[model samples]
Structure formats: C-alpha cells, structure tokens
Target: MASRLVAAAASSSSSSASPLARLISRRRLAGGADPHGPAKVNLWQDPMSPSKWKEEHFVLASLSMWGVVMYGGFKIFAGGKKENKNEAVPTQV
Candidate 1:
C-alpha cells in the first residue's frame, strides 16, 4: 500500500512540473515587445541629423551648451578682482 502511494505521488509531482517548466523556459528578444522606430546613430556619425542621434548624445550636447552659456554670462556680468590700496610696496634693502 505504501508503494502504491509513492507511485501516485511521483505521477502527480511530474504532471505539476511541466507547467512550471513551460513558464520558465519562455524566450524573448532583448528590449522585448517595445514599439521601435528607426535606429538612432551617434551624434558624430551624423552631425546634421539631430533627430537620428542617440537620446543620450542629445542630452549631453544640450547640457554642455547650457553650461557654456551660463559660464559666459557669469564672466561677462561679474566684475574682475580689484587691487587693495592698503598694502604697501616692499622696499629693497
């Protein structure tokens, strides 16, 4: 009677295993199921085609341009260092 119970348990265990195996074994491509448009190229690869440049490249370029603009504006508006009149010139011995 124990041997019959063991045999029934083994069969049930195997039948339950197949569905889990099927779920785990599914294959999908990288970047799966997303709607993709035309492939983007590097900014240097196609300088004129801003739309075709990679998103990261566009962001970096935009940030760099803004940094330059801000620095230039600051330099232009900020007054240069002034000399202190209180300091006396050193005399030669």
Candidate 2:
C-alpha cells in the first residue's frame, strides 16, 4: 500500500518532458525562426529611439528578481509544512 501510494505520488509529481519540449519546438517552428539565429534589433537601439526601453527593462528585471526571491522564500517556508502532512505513513512489517 505504501509502495503504491509512493508510486502514485511520484508519477503525479514527475511529468514527461516530451510534451513541454514538443510545445516549445512547435512554437519555435510557428515563429518561423531558428532558435540560434542572428541578432535582431535591440530594444535599446533604433531611429525611433528606445528611451523607455531601458526603464522598462530595469523595472521588469527588478520585479522578476523580487518574484523569484519571494517564491523561493515561500517554498522554503510553506513546503516544509506541506511535507509533514503529505508524507507517506510507514506500513507494518
């Protein structure tokens, strides 16, 4: 029973990577561009001028960093609490 529970949990937690890989490949193909292709126009360089681009980049980077930090912290704290509840109970010999 314990082994079955562990197997079920493991299967649910670990998914096949092929679907995600295929999705990314299909998206790349639909974009009609090589993933390793040449450089495109830089957001910070143009006759139209990317003045706001720098500010946008800074804001987005800051927000992303904050999000990652907060998420990691939350997982570190919240994961332990959930871990205790979800642990598989030991079976009698």
Predicted model with the maximum TM-score: 1
lDDT of 1 by residue, 1-93 (tens): 565456555656566665444334224465676658888899999998989999999999899999999988888888556687888889999
Query: Can you give the lDDT of residue 71 in candidate 1?
Result: 89
Residue range 51-84, candidate 2, lDDT tens digits: 4345566566568889999999998988655434
C-alpha RMSD by candidate, in order:
9.9, 29.0
Candidate 1 whole-model C-alpha lDDT, 0 to 1: 0.76
Clashing pairs in 1: none
Residue 42 lDDT, candidate 1, scale 0-100: 99
**Stretches > 4 Å off in candidate 1:** 1-24, 28-31, 79-93
lDDT of each: 0.76, 0.58
